[model samples]
Target chain A: MDIHEYQAKELFTEAGIPVPPGEVATTADEAEDIARRLGGRVVVKAQVHAGGRGKAGGVKLADSPEAAREYASAILGMEIKELIVKKVLVTPVEDIVSEAYVGVLIDRANQAPLFMVSPEGGVDIEQVAETNPDAIRKQSVDPRYGLLPHQAYALADFLYDDPKLVRQATKIVGQLYDAFTKNSCSLAEINPLIVTPQGEVKAIDAKVSIDENAFYRLPRVEAYRDLDAEPESESRAREAELSYVKLDGNVGCCVNGAGLAMATMDLVKYYGGEPANFLDIGGSSNPDKVVAALQIITADPSVKAILFNIFGGITRCDDVANGIVEATRRIDIKTPIVIRLTGTNEAEALEILGEAGFSAHTSMDEVVQKAVQIAAQA
Target chain B: MSVFIDQSTRVVVQGITGRDGSFHTHQMVAYGTQVVAGVTPGKGGQTFEAGNGARIPVFNTVEAAVRETGANASAIYVPPPFAASAIMEAADAGVALIVGITEGVPVQDMMTASALVQDKGVRLLGPNCPGLISPGKSKVGIIPGEITIPGPVGVVSRSGTLTYEAVNQLTQAGIGQTTCVGIGGDPIIGTDFIDCLEAFAADGETEAVVIIGEIGGTDEQDAARWVKDNLNVPVVGFIAGQTAPPGRTMGHAGAIISGSEGTADEKIRTFKESGIAVAERPVDIRDLVKEGLGL
Candidate 1:
């Protein structure tokens, strides 16, 4: 659930964090209007859910409104890591004296939101942590009490020596944590927290990833999803409560559990076949889910065969068998389907499959190997 | 004897009136687990009829359930929103162990609840897990009792159906397990490979161990190092998500490769370095287990 930089800045503003005013434009005309209103040099940043935006030529510093439109028009349809830039953020440029990194994220190892601050900024923090770990100072915040004022100051002190700069940095750190917790974000960062020559601290670039599990509470953050940046199959699968990740392969994997889904995909490669996609039918026992899965898989023309390996626990195998039988009738599935189901009414499942003129295997290895062979041949 | 639970372990079911809770409650009772009490917040002062005349008392809170039934452990099946609080409730009630089976709980909530768990010195198994089964003794959470049998091997996994798949294979191949634990696949689970392995190492009944891990955290690698230095039992390991793409969370929130970290190849390499046999496929686990047992 990665939101665009402009959306993150909006949240940062709401939290009383200082961010340069920016407007998101879906068109070049809109970008030009935004730049003209700002009446100064502006930065046009491509709003795509990916890194390397600068390297992809998706970011440009425009000295005029006409230049802003030109940059936006060029970046709008451009792809960075295969994500099309459908929107661009037009913000007035800032005169920076220095840059620093500040961020907070749910650290799995610490079981809390961990704040990381670095004097080095405007680069991949992961790379920095790897090459020069000492440059980055980290603090694990107690999610119960959140980032205390003193705790924020300790992290802020590492980024600045000036009293005014440290004070602003400390406030920005607390404000970032506020935005992170309020939006149920998994990660929130202000890369290149620039120190203006006028002695002001402001966030120039923002990245925030929302935790989908918290969507039940944060309705506004959930609405920040950009479908234009997502793959069609992925968006469609989400509509059906299925977790899908498309891959360039011939064997289409449909499994019951997440871990099992990955293992099935791995086994497809182990048997010398690439998996077309990773689709988890999840705990939904509805035949419609199976129909949805079939439609999503067959939509990809590269899918030579469909493989379903369901070790039913909470998910019923009979329901899946019925789903396969029902889906084949509902949708004209030309791809050869191979199923391997075991546990939880397996006999009834096998009977349903047999009656539908489809033979199913109970061994995971056999079905994966069979599907891989069928895909390779097709 | 199992690592966590034995025949003497008393159980309390949280969210007992819910769909999954009531269903697994009956399943647990049918398998001879001592499900003494149930909790449903407002549905207290009632009896949940778990067939066979097993009328379990329902309390409004975990505290009352623990006090009334002397329940030492809790099996949680609450909704995602309330699941973390339910875990904290059980921990606050002084339960030694709490097994959370609810999925979709916010990581932030678990972050707070798990920290409280550590402060309370209570063991929380999972907020999204299949729980544990002590083959033919006592079972907690949702592991199917039919697939297990009392034996010398102990199993620890970070998956649901995958654990069932492996345990079923072991049972079908006559390699009965003493207990099979699903520590869960969430990013911030309360227990990890190290905790389960330590419990198994202390348990005298566990002759051999099988570690089932997936791509995500460095928990498996950390467990590998700990096993190499401390434990002496024969260990066979399996790492899922070998072909999974980086950055995309494959089914589990925690099962993702971040910047070339927590990959199956890396975990497998570490397992080999720690002298653990790595099962290339799920079915290969049976043969590997047999080999480890020298059978």
Candidate 2:
């Protein structure tokens, strides 16, 4: 649910927060055009869902439109954190007098939305909190009442000395809080809220992560999800209603629950084999979901063996057995599958698998070890 | 003897007409739980036939169900979209314990619902949890009744099947449990490991405890600290996702390794430092539980 910096800035702008005028461009020509329109030194930042883009050479300061185009061309296809840059955000560089940090995120410990503000900025806030703990001032906003004017000003006062700067920062903090709550964001931040030489405060960099569960309520925020930025298998798994994470190992794991799925993956590693992916078919087992899960797992050429570990609480073992059987019939699965099915009609599920010429075990350890051995040999 | 529920727990089911609600309701009834009432918005006044051919009355709202049936406990199987409201409704009805089995509830909604539940002084378990089971006495939510037996150990976990795996192993090893509770896998859950731990610490039936945790949040660390400061019962702990990669959610929304925190290695270290036996594998939980109990 991570949105591009430009998209976050768009939200910031919509919420009345001052942001450096920026345009997203997919091509170098568009970048040049945007720079020309801005009529100043522009910053070309790669619009990828990752941090440390500047350190990875995905961001550059361009002195002219031609320089902007050059930077765009260089960064367009560059890979940062395994994600290829498909677009660049072109924004006019601001004349900054000082930099500060402001952000709001769901504090898991407090079970509330916490606003963190610091005079120090342009670096990881976590590092700042660790190194100079006194620099960061935090306030938890009750979701019901939201960030009151006083609370916002207190946070602003911590980051600024000038009355005018504090007023502007307070307004910006309110706007950021509005944007966060309106979009159902898990995290929203304006890293390096820059103070101009003229004393105007504005957000220079934006980061907003929408809570995935809120997608049902926030259609606009859900639409901001860039499918191209995610791996194909992940999106496909999402569409199939499967919880999947592609991994680097050779053994593909399909389990019923998230906890058990992780346990299964850990067991795969425990037996001296790596898991190629983490796939959860979830509580309700349908043949089509299993087929989709298998297809997604086998889509990874690195997968040498597949494992199914179903504990079957709400999920029926017979349904999973039917899925494995139906999936093998519909798709040509080249990798060996080791299944451990137990609970909820397990005897019937074993019969179904046995008749389909597939052997199933009841023990998790034996099946995981067998799958690991098979994957290792392959 | 159980920490939460026993045979006396009068249960009302929210979303009773729904698929998951009906299925688990039948399971709970079959497990000998006193499923007194059911709540379905438009389907109120209908009768849900339990496994024993007993007709359970369905009401339109939790308040009505609570009033009519004198139900003090509620198990929720509502969809994610309505789960928060359902929890609030149950809490508003003055239900002492509300168990939510719905997964994928928006974190913001849960935050509000949690606040309301707290204001009402009600205990809310899992908006995405498997609920709790007092073995051979009362079964709530979706934990299979057959796997557990009434005994001395108290089980608390943030997982569903992983809890079952530990319970299954314990049953195989002739170690039975007093009550097994799933605190859920969400980052912002109502009840936590510490809440269940304190309850178990006070319950005379629970001689020892087994905790199943995953790589997410500092709940485990906090729970370990609580166990150290309080509680005399020996505790065994196991954390899943030992091999899980960072920043990727293993399965549950809350089961992600954020930054350097919420890792299995860190949790295991904290558990050892707190004098809780750490099980390397799920299969090893039984042996650790036995050791914790001095069996």
Off by over 4 Å in 1: none
Model 2 scores a TM of 0.99
Per-residue lDDT, model 2, residue B190, is 93
Q: Fraction of true contacts kept, per model?
A: 0.78, 0.80
Measured over the true interface residues after superposition, the C-alpha RMSD of each candidate is 1.0, 0.9
The parts of candidate 2 lying over 4 Å away from their true place are none
lDDT per residue as tens, model 2, A66-140: 999999999999999999999999999888899999999988988999999999999999999999999999999
TM-score per model for chain B alone? 0.99, 0.99
Give TM-scores for every candidate, taking all chains together and pairing residue i with residue i: 0.98, 0.99
Q: What TM value does the first chain of each candidate achieve?
A: 0.98, 0.99
Write candidate 2's Cα lDDT for B1-295 as tens digits: 9988999999999998898899889999999999999999998999999778978999999999999999999999989999999999999999999999999999999889999999999999997899999999998889999889989999999999989988988997889999999999997999999999999999988899999999989999999999999979889999999988888877788998887989999999999999999988888889878887888
| TM-score (C-alpha) between model 1 and the true structure | 0.98
Q: Which 10 successive residues of model 2 chain B have the least lDDT summed?
A: B244-253
Write candidate 1's Cα lDDT for B57-118 as tens digits: 99999999998899999999999999999999999999999999998999988988998999
